[model samples]
Target: MCFVLYAGTSMPIPQKEWRNDVPGLSVEALTERESPIAVHFSKPEVRYIGSTSGCGCDFPHVMFQNGDWPWFDDGEHDPEQEASDRYNREALVNLLQATGEQTVELYGVWDGDFMTPPAVREEIALTVIVDPSFRFREQGLYVVRVA
Candidate 1:
């Protein structure tokens, strides 16, 4: 699966508070050995769309780059990269909604490990949302239309 990096204005709500929000699924939290940040989770049967980069790749990497993520701009840019960023942001939005968490302010998807083969990377980037509500009918970009 593709990797999406994310950051929010506030820390995610504690598992104790949001666990029950996702019905019929079990949530497991993980803490990185090198960092104090705890933003990883695991859930069974959660039909995640897009590519899967195996275990330990399920969580978004929390980034703090002085707020200089490339996607956070409105100037002229590459159309393909813009769409990829949008798709990732929309995925994060839907994920947060599904888990009953507040929307994050910064996030974007990338080819996991930066070592995926070019062909595989291209396919991952092109994975469209099959859910009608999230798919932009004419543009082919995925977005959270209902929430």
Candidate 2:
């Protein structure tokens, strides 16, 4: 049950690192430069590559669309897209939960990131793809507390 976790709000700064107990999982602070483009040109086929050692954790390897692209836009998650979007999100969350990061927090997610990234809007959807029931409640979205 391999999956890619979309963490943080809006376009991630790309500098912020998401730390977790999962060993191989790569905590990337994504931004439009990497994600928006990935979705814009993602492939239609979705494949789960179980887990891998590359990231040091048992993170699932999702074969994103076209093999080269890392993300996909399954159309708008509106009324028409709700069922499928929920299915995808649930399946992804379920897999993450099963892997032990049950409390993985999906951050920076909103309704608009699904439609598209407007030049001025800039607010991208960041999802806490993991389920909330997991013990890792502390692992959800939040702004960094600065001193």
Candidate 3:
């Protein structure tokens, strides 16, 4: 999972030397440039990539469009979840890699958020695409954070 830039937010600045943990996952932040998804949606900050790396961590986050959320969740309990989450996340990313190189631009992402820790959650509106085999995949989006 990679993150692209957008205007008006306090997301972290990207640093070099970040490792890509997700396979075939490409996401980017658009700073000072127009986005391809702009015509369909409002000004978006992120873009899909054919083959490139973002300055953040790639963790598959199965978020909800149902408005459900993890109440009281944070990094305090992360050590317990890391191993299993990594395994599941890899599976999800692998599935999404089958789509277009630059699928859609996203709304509400801050400057890649590459330097932020995974504990904090940012609200993102993603392009909806349905893959019958994976109903949950209808929503495809990722947050770029520090490893």
User: Which candidate number would show the highest TM-score if scored against the true structure?
Assistant: 1
lDDT of 3 by residue, 80-131 (tens): 4454444434533443333322332223222333333232334322222122
Q: Model 1 segments beyond 4 Å from truth?
A: 1-35, 39-75, 101-147
lDDT of 1 by residue, 37-83 (tens): 21221211112222122221233232223432222335657766445
Compute each candidate's TM-score over C-alphas.
0.30, 0.25, 0.23
Of 1 and 2, the candidate ahead on TM-score is 1
lDDT of each structure? 0.29, 0.30, 0.32
- Model 3 misplaced stretches (Cα beyond 4 Å): 1-70, 74-80, 104-147
Model 3's lDDT to the true fold?
0.32
| Candidate 1 overall lDDT versus native | 0.29
Top lDDT: which candidate number?
A: 3
**Rank order by TM-score, top first?**
1, 2, 3
Number of colliding residue pairs in model 1 = 3
